[model samples]
Target: MMLSHYLIVSGILFSIGFLGVLLRKNTLVVLMSLELMLNAVNLLFVAFSRYNLSLDGSIFVFFSITVAAAEVAVGLAIVVALFRLKQTVFVDAFNEMKN
Candidate 1:
């Protein structure tokens, strides 16, 4: 119920997401981790907004969710295309994309 609680949880979520993005090789896991990180930021915005007694944070979260939805759609499509081309979801497999 306290601001500290929200901050701690948000920090944990962000850390986990950051590690997942850094240590995982799977593209899907990386994408999910990115989502986790984004959600953590959203939680912080909401907590601060509530603490400040304003609706701005919630409104920002709404738009953030909308953008995240669009990102997932496009990201998944790209992943699907990559899989079709390479037969694997591991990030390392796409190194040839540089060429």
Candidate 2:
């Protein structure tokens, strides 16, 4: 596969994730969308690494994956806590943070 092919796929994935984040009302779906976007970036990093025959991009991807995993963990924890508090996972339902 060519670099352009990888880039095109990454762009499509990013666009889908962006749309999901903007249009989805559910917190869990939004989080998943965010993860999708992160993965798209990771794909780009790996692709460039391969194209350039370098290890730096791959190293960056490793860190990106680590950070993404941490993000998912924290995001899910927040979502679960919010659900327990309000019994709902809709983004709009979280407009007010005060008791």
Q: For model 2, how does the per-residue alpha-carbon lDDT over 1-99 read when each residue is reduced to its tens digit? A: 889999999999999999999999999999999999999999999999999999999999989999999999999999999999999999999988566
RMSD to the native, candidate 2? 1.7
- By TM-score, how accurate is candidate 2? 0.94
Q: Given candidate 2, what's the lDDT at residue 43?
A: 94
Clash numbers, per candidate: 0, 0
- Give all candidates' CA lDDT scores: 0.96, 0.96
Error of 2 at 16 (Å): 0.5
- In the range 53-89, model 1's lDDT, one tens digit per residue, is 9999889999999999999999999999999999999
Q: Please state every model's RMSD to the true fold in angstroms.
A: 1.1, 1.7
Misplaced by over 4 Å in model 1 are 97-99
The residue pairs in collision within model 1 are: none
* Global Cα lDDT for candidate 1: 0.96
Candidate 1: residue 67 Cα off by (Å): 0.7
